[model samples]
Target: MTAQHGHTADRATTAPPVTTAAAARDYARSVVRQRWDSASRTAREEDVVDLLLVVSELVTNAIRHGDGLAAFEVALAEDGVRLTVHDNSDAVPDVAYGRGELPSGGHGQGYGWPLIIRLAREVVIEPRPGGGKSISVLVPLHARP
Candidate 1:
């Protein structure tokens, strides 16, 4: 959410408010790269890709499904990156809150939630204080060999 550990107060760490999925992805990539570049080891390419996918899916869902993107935050952790996406809807996806099963029937939909569940850890969906929901996840990043 807000800057922590006295890190530099910049968009790279907190990100300016974004509306499109592409903008969110760009912001997330910058955050990941900035954090990993300054760390002891580099993040694996595949892991970064996974993180980007998750970022896109979440932001896209918020804008497309949820009313609209309310707030977006990305923070770096010791072993992974933390994402908190807020939307202007209170409805939480059944797949995300109920069972972590991928939708069976092919409908061109319901794939993003499953992909998010598969790639992210500590996934949480909670209703916001006002009238929306916040989805948070930790996407783990491994060091390159």
Candidate 2:
């Protein structure tokens, strides 16, 4: 990260391509963890935990539901961490807002949607021109003034 006019600029990172759903989660978590660990300052313990969880959920969803994890980006902003996952599938995800497990028993993977929605301060889903979608989530690191 570089300093811009005295304030620290957001640090962004992209993980290497992962082949499987489990690999996606593992790789994303490691990238996020390593980046922050090497930074000048450390994030709060709770924030770090939340970040890991968010990363796992998003990457897992991308690999499981979409064509695959096309790309993953992590940005450390002034206020929080932003994670974006892109997949090659055009199908939109069903955003579950309320509490309850997925209908497909423990084997199902959709349970992450509700948790992602609840943890993220903001969520945005965008469609690619060719065919695919990207989901972005911002997880706050500090309380707003």
Candidate 3:
């Protein structure tokens, strides 16, 4: 699903819930000023939109593949925004660049990470400190058109 990232004219605000992926991402659209504001502070509409989508996809993957015990968190820093999805599953996600063509599939399921790579500045899927895996994406604050 394509999402529209809207930046409000008001100052920064901490979104409630921050519980589920959908909730957290939906709140991101409303965060305008950001937590750390400086001369270099900035936020892009496209970047936020893509970031939310990535978070949603990763959360879905975790909930679907991982055990019931799972939690996700989002942080907005000066350099960029971070999204962490923690799940009980230790298996890391496989990156698919999709340089070639897809031979079609049942139910027409494909094309998620590939879009993510194209959207986000950096995407990293690594294991957490103790257990499970965390998918972190860094969306640059100073993105250009």
Taking all chains together, each candidate's TM-score versus the true structure is: 0.85, 0.72, 0.62
| Runs with alpha carbons beyond 4 Å of true place in candidate 2 | 2-11, 20-41, 96-109, 143-145
Per-residue CA lDDT of model 3 for 1-145, tens digit only, reads 1111333222223445344667766755444244423344445666666777876766667677665326655565555566656678887645533332333664333556666566565566677778887666655554443
Best of the candidates, lDDT: 1
lDDT of 2 by residue, 49-90 (tens): 677787788777777788788888777666567888888988
lDDT of 1 at 63: 90
lDDT of candidates 1 onward, in order: 0.80, 0.68, 0.56
Where does candidate 3 have its weakest 10-residue lDDT segment? Answer: 1-10
- The true-versus-predicted C-alpha distance at residue 140 of model 3, in Å, is 2.2
List the candidate numbers ranked by lDDT, top first: 1, 2, 3
Total clashes in model 3, counting residue pairs 3 or more apart in sequence or in different chains: 0
For model 1, the stretches where C-alpha displacement exceeds 4 angstroms are 1-13, 98-100, 107-109
Ranking by TM-score: 1, 2, 3
